[model samples]
Target: MNPSASQNIRPETVAKVRTGIPGFDSISEGGLPRARATLIAGTAGSAKTVFAVHYLAAGITQADEPGVFVTFEDSVADVRKNMLGFGWDIARWEKEGKWAFVDAAPDAEGPIAIVGDYDLGGLLARIEHAVKKIGAKRVSLDSLNALFVQFKDHAMLRAELFRITSTLKRMGVTVVFTGERIDEYGDVTRHGIEEFVADNVVILRNSLEEERRRRTVEILKMRGTTHQRGEFPFTLSSREGIIVIPLSQIQLTQSSSTVRITSGVKELDRMCGGGFFRDSVILASGASGTGKTLLVTQFMSGGFKAKERSLLFAFEESKDQLFRNAAAWGMDFAGMEQKERLMVVNRYPHAMAMEDHLVEMQQIIDDFKPNRVAVDSLSALERVSSLRGFREFVISLTSTLKQKETAGLFTSTSPSLLGGTSVTEKHISTLTDSIILLRYVESFGTMRRALVVLKMRGSQHDDAIREYTIDGKGMHIGDRLSAITGVLSGHTTFEGE
Candidate 1:
């Protein structure tokens, strides 16, 4: 095909500020707008200041763009001290004349020249001096709340915000102004100072639920470029600085190795679509003695055999009891742990805070980069946290697993009281990507277990509920129980048709 007339016109690439957030620039379609003021608004402790400082740090280290950080929340020394977590030597950077820190409150007492008889000229002149001194290209005001303390009227604060942004933009200085957001899940705050003035708006929100807390960053608006619109999960570490884990971005490499994992039962793999999906989440639910733990052991060992790392988080069983019981079923978890491919985490339901568990889980993932993760039963986690918290926990777990492309096989013990269908089952079923129910069906005067697929998103499987059996070797799906009378009564009488 010949090049069209429009194709002949090549567009120039616009300059952007590299924000230093891992996987973030990709979400922004490159980076933040250049020479424009961007508002990073959030409540206290939401890491807004850290993000702003890290952005400036990236400008200094990656782009060689000198930066000026004007703080209202912390002193220059305190700012430097806090940045130590990122392994950034603020003193070294300052000494090199590539960065400058200014405390706004200290300079406010000076005899100042008011720009146009309304603006803060002293602050502007100080900023200009710092910019010219080090050829700084970027600036960040720690927070606008501190800047607003002097102003009693809302109208004046908004005007001043506009003037400051305009002055910085005119100087070709890309700036980030951190502000406090009072309202959540909405545009701007009550003051509306940042919502109207800045060229770009970025919101960082910390959503607290009964089970977990999530930190997210969203680009509300970017003036001249296309950006991703999603609440991307972000994390700040003592070493990694800031990173955003985007969910939809699939990092599939050029390889389809048909990565096989043992499904605890050899026959169960044949029943499933050739083993559980690599890096997928599997929900296994059943009544007691359905061999959920045994099946999980087999799955974990499969990962070990494949030389891929895996973790088993047991909420109900003690490590010793699990080893002893699983040994009887031919699962050698202790042996796998010795090989360093498998890790067994045993925690009581009431022992640890749910938040600490999340942090620990992430740390393990970061350290191991495991191919498989198993939570023996989420019901234990649910017991410790509130319903809202449990939802957040599920979201966090799913989000993390998806982002890392790690397979997670979890169990949720369904009470026999509710049978195969009930509100409790429905609640958990809605949260998982796939649901596999194991239940006891009374047939021929005997209690038998059955396996059924409640749902499997993005894949098709058998719809029939089949008979399942557990023996010394492990769990297996048997032929459907065909002969039974009054099976729903929790008791069965056999009769020929």
Candidate 2:
């Protein structure tokens, strides 16, 4: 007798089981394959057990699906206590009959001796009973290597793995098996055969980059579905569990805004072809004391004045200091914040990783839903990440803001004090929709401020460098400084000299 056509259909067409972890489903191209075994491998302290617990917790809470967690390393009570720290009341879930645990950890008193030929039949039986008891749709066998370490024969270990995985698949329960990677860069599992037996494999890495610990996740293999194929940054937080930052998957679809938004300084707005597009990214680049932060403040203040919500990420200043500086220029930043029109987030650059900063910004943008955002200074962030990483982050951040139709203004500090040039100008200039240069011109034996629009991708802008003044009333753009040549180069000379 032949099987039905549906039986021969590819597994990819089957519906996926959503993991309910933030950003996990999106990066997995939905979620884990249904009714299949997935191997979660990592080194010590890599949060492998924590990841498994989260998977089960999410299934029980969000998917209305009962789950069974079979731990071979930690006791059921210990697992419960650890999960409680993460705000997951696994004990309560057990009482509600939504989840169950199989404690197969070796007794602390002594090791069990198995003299006869053995298989995982007893463990499989316990799992089957738990599934039948709670009607579980999800299962996790954490630290699968704990059971393998007991057997000396590699063939027996592989056979037991195949049996357990095949039995779980026949039960029609989506399963996750946590294993420890033996070498720093070797097989996904210590035994080297689990990865081959599992339907999917996800490797979690916690490595030091520049003496800072970085956590990343990569899908090594997936049998039926196409998953994102790069190592993406992830964070394990007490409140949100495993949150992945899928920066590599960001789409670059250009989202345009026909409406032009003011830059607060009326003359500067006029110079940018009547202000900036609503969803554009503007780079305000200059050296130290060139008023880059002030330009960002004015742009944010303009959004506040227009009744549009604004967010300011201050890397170098506190909220109070930013408010004081804005107040010096006649802008009431505190009042705007009090009115809920503005929000200022201050974070020291050294306090967190670049990926952490990206996650923070993503959360704030989601919660605040601001119409405008300003990052007062990318140079601080560059100090924390690699050049390539920084560029990727800028691209991801700007692309996300553009997709949300949020106008973003970012400040970059030129290394030279006399406006020699900026590395950021060469690197990030293409990612932005417009480039606004703030510089100091050395003309007539004195230093004077100048402003110019170097590039605006989709709009015409004034090419002439205009002199500007910063005072109690904020930036004031005067007539174009057509008399000075090399204004951008700091060594300016009279045009007719």
TM-score winner: 2
The estimated TM-scores of all candidates read 0.76, 0.93
Q: Which regions of candidate 2 are displaced past 4 Å?
A: 1-14
RMSD of each: 5.6, 3.6
Native-to-model Cα distance after best TM-score fit, residue 420 in candidate 2, in Å: 3.4
**In candidate 1, what are the lDDT values of residues 1-497, reduced to their tens digit?**
22221232444244576676776786776677878888888877889888888888888888898899988768788899989878888789899999998777545465444444355666778887888898889999878887676545567768767777788888889889898887667657546766668888888988775545567788898986667897876777666577765544534232122454555566566666566666567788777777778778888877877788888888999999988887887778788888788888888867655544665677777787788899987877877876754555666676677667788888877666325443334565665656777767765366677776666555556666677776787677777556654433344556764
lDDT of 2 at 273: 86
Highest lDDT scorer: 2
Residue 408, model 1: lDDT of 82
Instruction: Evaluate candidate 2 by giving its C-alpha RMSD to the native, one decimal.
Output: 3.6
- Please write out the lDDT profile of model 2 over residues 335-428, one tens digit for every residue: 9999999999999888877767877787899899999999988888888877766876798789779878999999988888776667776888
